[model samples]
Target: MLQHLIDQDEGLRMVPTDRNELTTAVGQLNEELRGLPEEADPARTRVLTRWIGIGQMCLGNHDEARTVLRQSLDLAAALGNTRAVVATGLNLGDAHRYAGDVQGADALYRSALNTARSHHPELVDFALQHTGKNLMERGDLASAKAHLQEALRLRITKGDAGLVESTQAALARVELLIGRADASAADGAVPRQWSGEWTSWLQSRTTAQTPARWAEDFPALRDAVRGLNAHQRVYPRHLRDQPFPAELIAAMAAEAEKAVAADGYLHNGKWNAPVGDAASRFAGQVDLAAVVARSTGLEVEQPHTAVYIAYLEEGQFLDFHVDEFGFGEANLILCLQHERPTAAPSVSTTVFITADGCLECDLAAGDCVVFDGALTPHGRTPLTAGESITLISLGFRARDQASRTVTNLPPVPR
Candidate 1:
């Protein structure tokens, strides 16, 4: 019931895939399992354990998952459940691979393949497919090709289009790996040809973003996250060098005071991703957030802005990225008003400037930093692990929108 409540509550409806949620959900499942009969229902227990293990693995808790899934595999073996064992072994292989025990992964895959042979042809083929994948990762191209080919033949004979297509894709990937792997081994430091091509391509594409360009295009922040998977943080860096002003801090506090009880949909008075049921918060807080937006000439793009709230002792941060694509010409971090009385009276933006500035700006409660968002996708060096720090942002499309009736400091001397 507790898990259900969290899942159902809109306020608690964060991304299910996030590590926090995964860990929480697994904890809940463990509690429920403890309450069950010692014998428990075998099938139910297996299913729950598998999913919980998968969730744990997702959160980088491989050791915990390994123990749980090993138990699950043992149960499967007791029931002669070949398919279940195969699935468990496959995921276990992944855990081992990620944990850097490649040899262990190879052995497990081989074991699963052997176990699956006595089962149906489909099961056998499935096991072989995974084994081939493992072999490919180990650079055993001949064995990988042989296993994958056998799996492909079995799928074709069984007239299973899905399996056939999947095996074929795997085969193609293996061939590609072999081609690259061989070259990688020979070159000792990346193939010179590919490196040269990539370098030239990067040179052609590289162009630093200017602060003024942020004012020219109103890029949405939500759109930027979709393509920036490799980036570990997301906050503006260019503005961290500047000192936070005293007057701006006062204005920000005043505004945060006005935000009390003003939240509706998107503005949950808490941190939330932009989406339906939160859209109202996005548009409603615009007036308050715009103050910061215009000051920095940066727009907030969480799909739903008003719904995005950062609370005291809380902050929202995006980890590193090039912030490429048309997400925005630049990114800005704005200091918002923290109206509620707290240990920290005012809010400030913190930008870790890395260039000649080597400067760490206080990002005073109201002062904001503006920087090249597109060229250097920003992110907090260390994403706050506790609840996200509360923040207000405006994803600006036009510079006119950035300080709409709001005043910004003079641009640093060019």
Candidate 2:
């Protein structure tokens, strides 16, 4: 009788004549799931749990959705139901991501991708979509684009209209971001040789190299990370009596100033002027990128994707947010200049609100700060009047190994 009632309710709610009626039908479905016998088959129970979890997610009850989906995933895995496991895992990953657990979502999606590859090759596209979406949200645009592009190709081969449409939309957005970054860059700011598909250039460097090899290739970078704080590291002009090349710094600053003019001031409560490709000339001319990579233990041979400048004027400040890109994880921030020089020289102070209380530092001109901006939330308090700061950012994907679990999954069977 209860099953019949749920079926009847679902039929009525299919079109959802009204919000209240649809919600009531969902409540009926929930009650039916709850009324199932304690001795019910685990697989059957998991099916119900998965449905309930998906419904909860659609209803915007993310916390309940995750709880329900986790139960489904656990039961499905124990039963060795590869199909159910992949389904529940993907749903649960989305739930966790919606709840702001990005790291957890990435892990879950990676595991799902692994399971799908080994047991259900047909589900590879589904798993890739979820993984790519999570990375995109986390600001790993380069990785996100790769995953989405692959998923789109698979979906095309499968001839799935719905999947193709959605994946294309995602791929387009990634392209748009790349396009914006390119358009915003100063003309002649980057050489034509450096102008090819930026993400593809990055992927080309994903050779099978161990961290030890990276350490050997870039010893200075390894040393820098070793002395890093939990969330950040500072590299003083170790050359002592010598600071960064003023000529190089000046060239970067000029490009940044021009970019700001072209792009206009970006304001989201706080004003910021992003100078695209501002540091390209310097990074391209000298071994600055190698030094930056070495400083962060990244591969010395791999090129950084983006190098830009940020002009933060007085009273303007950046809010706390983690980097969404892989390159953002090991960001190289160099202070170019600051107005209203103090006795100690004006600086843009950063406050890293970490799990271990707060760590504050004054990032002064000519000094470089290398830190995993993705793992922690760091921001600046508003600068005082007549105070301004220019910072050059070198963003590279040095931690490609973290993605191997998903990307290196066995290829889908023909």
Candidate lDDT values, in order:
0.50, 0.59
User: lDDT score, residue 153, model 2?
Assistant: 93
Question: How much is 11 displaced in model 1, in angstroms?
Answer: 35
Model 2: per-residue Cα lDDT over 10-51, one tens digit each: 211112234455456567767878888989888777887887
RMSD of each candidate? 17.3, 21.0
Pairs of residues at least 3 apart in sequence or in different chains that clash in candidate 2? 138-324, 139-324, 139-325, 140-324, 221-294, 221-295, 327-396
What does the lDDT come to for candidate 1? 0.50
Can you tell me which runs of candidate 2 are displaced by over 4 Å? 1-22, 181-414
Candidate 1 per-residue lDDT over residues 1-414, each given as its tens digit:
223322211211112444565677779888777778977778777777776666666565667767777787787778778789887887677566544455567778877777777664458887888778777766688899999999999989999897898889888888888888777566533223332332243223321122222322223322332332122223344333234454544444444333433432332223333212122322333353354355454454432222234444334333233332233433445554433324543333243223222223444344455554433333342223232243444343433333211012111111
TM-score list, all predictions: 0.39, 0.43
